[model samples]
Target chain A: MATLELQGIRKSFGTTHVLHGIDLAVAEGEMIVIVGASGCGKSTLLRIVAGLETATEGRVIIAGADVTRLEPKDRDIAMVFQNYALYPHMSVFDNMAYGLKIRGLPKAEIRARVQQTADLLGIGQLLERKPRQLSGGQRQRVAMGRAIVREPKLFLFDEPLSNLDAKLRVQMRAEIKRLQRRLGVTSLFVTHDQVEAMTLGDRLVVMHEGRAEQVATPMEIWRAPANTYVAGFIGAPAMNFLAAELVEGGAAAKLKAGATIAFADGVHPGGEGAPLIVGIRPEHIQAGSGPGSLPLKVDLVEPLGAESLIHGALPSGETLTVRMSDCSPLAGSVLPVVLPPASLHVFDAEGRRIEAVRRRERTAAAGAVGA
Target chain B: MMHGPIDATRLAAAERAAMKAEAARRRTDIVTHAILILGVVLFALPIWIVLMGSTHDVGTIARGEVPLLPGPYAVQNYLTALGEGSARTTRVPVALMMVNSFIMALLITVGKIAISLTSAYAVVFFSFPGRMVAFWSIFITLMLPVEVRIFPTFKVVSDLGMINTYGGLIIPLIASATATLLFRQFFLTIPDELVEAAKIDGAGPLRFFKDVVLPLSVTNIAALFVILFVYGWNQYLWPLLVTTSGDVETIVIGIVRMIGSEADTDWNLVMATAVLALLPPVAVVILMQRWFVKGLVETEK
Candidate 1:
């Protein structure tokens, strides 16, 4: 296993800059997933690390040695492309053995290594089949086996599972995670899927518009996002943002929906009547009749088998989405709901998260922790 | 609509309709087979006549009483035409001409495939300066067929002291734009990720070419070999224009020369050489038919 450090990597094509500047340090055996929307430069960053694309300004260091100027073949990295990129004419065994042959490994050793990797990937019987003869999932396994047989310093995956069917994608996601854990090789995975990022990575680098909006563990990113983009990008059905302002000495915010919700952790550091974007995940919002409950006029209820999403507007006509378990529409169109104090994420006018200041808690649990 | 006990009358009518449809299909099959038989006969009759004419005497053919049945002089005539009977009668034997044609055709086929594969690879994969210009230059040669550029080409070959050499016969015809274009089209459909993956696998450009590109191009090479071999084997004008000596004579030219302009034309020898010349191309086509169809039809794995 080896550490990888990317220093201020920037990429541009002529006048159009794809990646502004990205800096990341990955520890040994860690899995870092760079997740973003389409054209967000995540794949470009992975390619830069793989030495397929040159970073215009930055250094790519693997195992504490600079590889920025090296060719992809010399970089000691293996990549699994989105399309699996197996040699179509080669048998599965030959595909896995190609890199080892290129590296001049002993013939016996290459054979043994390929056999072991194929067994590991559960594709032992498929060694003689051509890529076109295999199913998509089997081909994906062969691609993975090819990289594993090389045992390079680092592994790069560029949306390797996106081409699989939904069920197969979920299955392979777990397989990849298990294999990464078993091998303990440092890996950088680029994906546009938030679910894959959340489930796979040791740390998720949530990117937006050529920038890393936030880099933290998945739960940390979930519980506390650095900005509105990260908060919205990490969660499904998206975290709902309501326009609000600091009222009651920064301890509470008055929403444009005519509900004043207080902060339970600590008071935010802001002046009076400062504009804020209060983000609360739909799953965190409860339909209730408590003291802080506010009226929600139910517009639509989307039932998702075990749970449901209650989409509606508040009293002052501000829209809010509430996800709750066993949530069916009641007799009345108006359903009382409460945005819990602990779950409210406060952002400033510029859409950056405002970490609440706790005066007495010396442990500083609010600090971002890397798991 | 069944208004009776079992609707048997309507069932019989339907059965009769089906029988009528079957009869119609049988008639269509007969017509189709008739056309196919006509095509087979149209293509086979001339070759059969040539085969029968090769066994006859020159007087028998000259008097236009060419026999359609097997003749007794088959072995004698073949031996005489093959130059095993008399060494002084022919300047080049049929065996030597065939060997020359085979060498020219094989060289042209292999050389064309190698040049075309590499050229197409470079055009598709590399990004050097004037890359497209180089590609367009090769592509533009598709407009200039061999007949159009024969004079300049012959002049170049003559100036290079290659007028009567095998290199003169093969090299000029080796750089084929059609084969290159076909290869280029094939290379374009190869995904970019495959190249990148090969790069990551520590494969240099040439290694990738040998291990990946060459293997994938098997069917394509097989298809082009048949085309280019026949093309080289059938060269009469260019070979005639370039070669003044009899040592570099190809089978096509050897067959043409067997017939004299005056009345002393050896029709049997000509027919014999013509029959011999047809064997190699037929063998190549039959050998490569599977790959040729696959290469043309299904491109991707």
Candidate 2:
């Protein structure tokens, strides 16, 4: 395994620029998942790292060697494409052995290597069959096996499981994760699905509009997002944002109007009476008539087998989503709910997290990061 | 009630008329087969005439005295033409000309199809500088026949000292625009996913072509082979211009020569040679009909 670094990478096709300057580092044996919407340059970045595409400006250092201008063959990396790309004419064994054969490896060595990889992938019986004879999941495994046999310093995957059905996708995702862990190879995986990124990566890189929005450990990104986009993107049923202001009443900073809630001294010291965007996770908001309870009008109730998501509106007419364990009585009725004091996240006018009074608790450690 | 009552005699006549119509329909089936047999006979007549004529004496042929059915099977005419028991001294028969024609046709067919497949692959897959211009330039040749450029092509061939050589016949006839464009259009439908997969598998351009593209292109190649073989085998004008001597003359030229030396034409010998020249192409078509039809029909899907 080896570390890979991309510094100041930019790409353009004629006048249309696809990637701005992007700098990222993949540590040895680490799995990095890049998540983004379509055309967000996530796939392009992965392709550049694989040397299937060249960056117009920048350097790619893999295993401490510059490979930016090299052809994909010389890059010493393997890629698993979305389509699986198994050689239709050859058996799975031959497809897996193609790279070794091209490099003039001996016949016995190539066969042995292919056999070992196939066995490890539990596709030994499938080795004799052509790609057309295999199922979608089998073909995907073959594609991964072809890459694994090479044992390159880096592995690139461009949404390898996107074509599979939901159940198969989940199964393959776990299989891929297990295989990657067993091999301990440095990998760069690209996907538009946030769940896959969260579940697979040691470090998840969220991208938006040709730039990295945020890069952190999955749990860290979930708990303390760098910005509103990361907070909204990383979780399901996304975090709800409500318009509010930081008002000065006493030594403790207080939020305006929803309910009487007091914070520790010096909370959000940016200024008083400043417009702010208050974000709270749906799962974090408790449903009850309590000290900080605020009346809400229920609009929709979604029971998802284990948990329920309640869609309701705030007094100010802003839509808020609340997640609960059981279906709420106020699902189709008006009711009161409370947001525990610490559960709320306040973002200043510029859409940045306001330095809370307990700054060192979350934002201080997560400062200097942006999504 | 009286109006509803029908006459038994009239009902019986109607039933008899229906039976007669069904019998007439069955009789037409026999008539149809008879006409089909007649058509087959008509098609085989010219071939039978040619085979019988090839064995008869030229004098008998010119006088139209040879029997339509196999007459006394004169092996002597063949022997004479083949320089065996002949009156003429040191006669060199026409067998060498047939051999030469066969060799030229094979070369042209193989050369044309090979070049066409590669050219089509380049245009369909690779994106390079001047790709559109290159594709259009080749495609435009489909509308412009070789006849239009024959003089210049002849001049170029002569300048290269290729006249009277196999190169003269092979080079000018190779690289067909229609075949190239046809193969390109067929190749365009192969899913891009296949190519992408090949690339990620560490197969470079040449490897991808040989392993992925070529394997899937079997049906198209078989189809193009028949097309190009017929085109090359039947080519007349260009070969006529290039091949100046009897040594290099093709089967068509040989058939044209069989009528010759003067105004009096040996129609029998001419037809006989024409029938002889038709065999190889017919054999090729019959041999690869399965693959040919497969190419034509399978490519649409």
Candidate 3:
């Protein structure tokens, strides 16, 4: 296991800049998932770390050595490509043994290592089968076995599960997590799926527009996203953003959709009547029946066996989605809902989250009543 | 319920029509196979004539009564061509010419494939300056074949003092644009991930070529061997212009020499030698036909 550090990595192709100064430090045995939509430069950053592509300006330090100029082989890393990239002409054993043979490992040692990795991956019976002859999941295991056999300082996975069916993806996802835990290898996995990032990563790097919006543990990022981009990105069905302005001496936000949410922790640092974006996750909004609560003109209902999602438009024409665990509100009807003050996230006009500074007794009482 | 009888009648009519259509299709298939068999017989008649004529004596064949039936002199005529030289013609033994032809064909096929594979590999993979220029330079030669530039090629070969040598016979015809173009097209179809995977596996360029490129190209190589072997075996004009001595003479040239001044020719020996010349290429094609088809079509990869 080794620590990996990427210092001020920037990449640009001609006039099209892909990454704008990405900096990160991965401790030993950490799995960091760089996740975003297509073309967000997640794969490019991983390639730079793997020495497959050079950064326009930065150093990649692995185990305290500068390897930015070294070739991929000299960098002592293994990458499982998005397509697996298994040698079609080689058997499973040969595909896993190729790197060791290239490094001039003794034949017996190579055979022993390949066999052990095969058993570890549960592909011991497939050592003689060619890549094309194996099923997709079997091929995926072979690809992972190939990477694991080398015992490199770092492992790079480029959406290795994207090609599998949904059920198999979940299976392989759990298997990869278990394998990474058992090996304790520092790894970087790139994907466009946020659910995968949330499940498989020890920490998540939510990227947007070639820049990392937030890099924190999965729960930390989910609970306290640094900006509206990340808050709306991590949770399913997305977080609802309302147009609002800071009122009550900058202690609460007044939504244009007809609700006022006070900061539960304390008063935020901003002047009164400043324009802001109020964020709240769908599951945190509690349905109510009182007249003074926010009115939602229900447009659709989606049942998910354990919960139902209510999508509706407010009086101000802003749409909101609410998740209720045991209620199914009918469409084309008015439903009353309450946005808990403790669950509200207030952002400035620039979409940067405004954190609370001081705890106040009155706002704490409000949080308790809302809960 | 009211439509049942009418539906049954309609179904009966449809079945009759289908049977008629099936009969017509069967008739068409019979005619098609008849024409195909006629074409095959027409194509094979000359080879059969040569095979049957090679068994007759020189007098019986030279008298313009080329027999369609077998004669008793088959083994003797073949032995004369194979073991001894024709007395009236070039006097070079057919066996020696056949061996020379085999050597020239083998060298040309192998040399062409090797040069083309390395060139295509370089053109497809590397990014050297003038890489496209070099590729287009090679591509431009496709339009200029051996016959088109025979005089200039002969001057170059002769200027290098390579006349009548195997190098002159093989090297002058080695720079094949077709094989290079086919290989380049195929190498392009190889996904970029394979190359990157090889690089990550610590395989250098030469090592990648040996371990990855060469093994992946077996079918294509086998396919090219069949075509190039025939191309080399049938080489007539270039070998004729480059070689003057019997030492480097090929079977094709020897066959031509055996037909000199028809009155003094040994026709049976020529026919026997011709049949011998056809055997090597046919053997190569038969042995490698499976790979040839696979290379041109669907593959496991």
Candidate 4:
């Protein structure tokens, strides 16, 4: 059974619609991440689930019960905020035990729970110190301990690691994943960082303009983005897009830059000469001449130790970036690069994925490789 | 070339430049100190004269020559001011007036802070019908000070039969907007995440106020306490209009009454009452000076 469900959630603040209708479900103990840029309503959706916000039109069901109208305290959820939000005046121990005390748990039980969680987070010695005195990472641990001690039915995180330095963020990211897995609690984490979303979520909900652009595992999202926004947003050194038209009965696409690349199989879903978008990740292109290769005029080279990025323009003045192993290529030289048919992602003119040809071929190839 | 004859002209020119810079710095330092000292003396003169006058006999003060030195009668003047009431005024002891002032100030400061803190919390943290309307109504009170609309407020207090009571003196003046505005501004600076975090921790609105909001507001409360206490203690007009009886009279009103009409006025006793009145506010400011400065600067920010 799904542990949490949001059905047709819609929100508007004074006629300014912040969230369009959103629907989602989380299986028991699954970690779902809602990732989006700022103002995309990801945080608003999380707040609605936490019972901090009331959806304009929808039902929020937790543990098979409708809790859309309940207060946040009665929702049986724990949240860790980006700023940690540990009570400034309370000791670390008191901060962790605050929720339990409010729930009318006995003193002994609250103490034991807080101590156990504090020890787990390795903040046992800092229990007597106030939040103002601890380092940022320590405060973050205390915040997580506060949530963990509650033992609530659901966990919500709103960019909890965004405040920390990069190194600490990575460390805390692993700690949170490990803790969540061990606790086996259903969780929803919201973040704008694509790498964090990719590494942390069991399934990522990529949101754009108050809509969920796509929901899939990280590898699936990387391999096949649902739209132009998701394709540009999910990768570091994002995917490159080029205008193209399907030709030769959809067996191949002729780029506007005048390069024709063949599909893996002669399968065409659209009519001949249909306008399309060709999406290719930087890492997918290789530096070599082949049957369907295009010559690229190298403009700049970025050497990053083990690998180098070759930034260049095609013959028709369209820019392209190719990630390759470290090798010094002279500037202003024409390098022939190949685009394998299986590596190309084709989208319609409206930026929606057209999976008729490539998806089937990729899955079949995967099945063959697995067999 | 053995340093080219020691270059006496360049060395002399460098020394002359250094001497000129030194003289200019000395002149600026002298002028700065002179201006600061003048400002200090100008502000301190009235207080110094009052202090010296309070130590003298009534006859010496009545001569119209400002007393420049402490007299031999400092102890007797304060004793008579605190114990025996001034003869020309209604014979309620200054001690009783001091107590009344203290009580009124304490009540007003505490009442205003309590009211402002809760109202500001509601305005900033919760959303309800008329939230902004209520906030704007409170904010509008800043323009309508106690001096304005004084008659209506007094009439209301009289209708409630609270005339000559401490409530009449404090309650009508308790609903101030500056403190509420200060608190509201400070509360808005509290990150919304703290409230959300508290909610997720199973805290209700009241719990969040007490545990999170109140602690964060300590400096602000202390700071406002100093300012509001002085404001309450120094209230003269309202107390005079409301308290017809000497028993409920504040020290500020009592001091004004100490001066008799014409030549019979006891200036020494009036100055003594002034000194006593100055003590509580001065002590409050001194005690909470650190938090006061921090609160003032931070709340403004």
Best by lDDT: 3
Compare the candidates by TM-score and give the number of the best one: 3
In model 3, the clashing pairs are none
lDDT of 2 at B72: 56
lDDT of 4: 0.89
The digit string of per-residue lDDT tens for model 2 on A1-371 reads: 89999999999999999888888999999999999889999999998897778899999999999998888888888989898866666788988998898889999999999999999998998988878788999998999999999999999999999989999999999998998999999999999999999999999998888888788999988877877888888888899887766666322334443765665334566556667777789999887896778777898888886888888877777888888885565566987887776777667767676656554654755664643
Question: Cα deviation in Å at residue A185, candidate 3?
Answer: 0.8
Supply the DockQ value of model 1: 0.67
lDDT of 1 by residue, B130-214 (tens): 9999999999999987899999999999999999899998899989888889999988988999999999998899998998888
Clashing pairs in 1: none
lDDT of 2 at B168: 90
Calculate DockQ per candidate and list them.
0.67, 0.36, 0.70, 0.57
Candidate 2 versus truth, CA RMSD in Å, comes to 5.5
True contacts kept of 4: 0.83
Please write out the lDDT profile of model 4 over residues B1-301, one tens digit for every residue.
7656577777888999999999999999999999999999999999999899999998997877789899999999999999987886667789999999999999999999998998898888888999999999999989876678999988899999999998888888878688889999988988888888888777888888888788779888997898899998998889999999888988998888888775888888999888998999998889889776775554331
Q: Candidate 3, which segments miss by more than 4 Å at Cα?
A: A289-292, A360-371, B1-26, B290-299
| Cα deviation of B26, candidate 1, in Å | 2.9
* Candidate 1 accuracy as TM-score: 0.93
Error of 2 at A68 (Å): 1.9
Where is model 4 more than 4 Å wrong at Cα?
A326-328, A356-371, B1-28, B63-66, B290-301
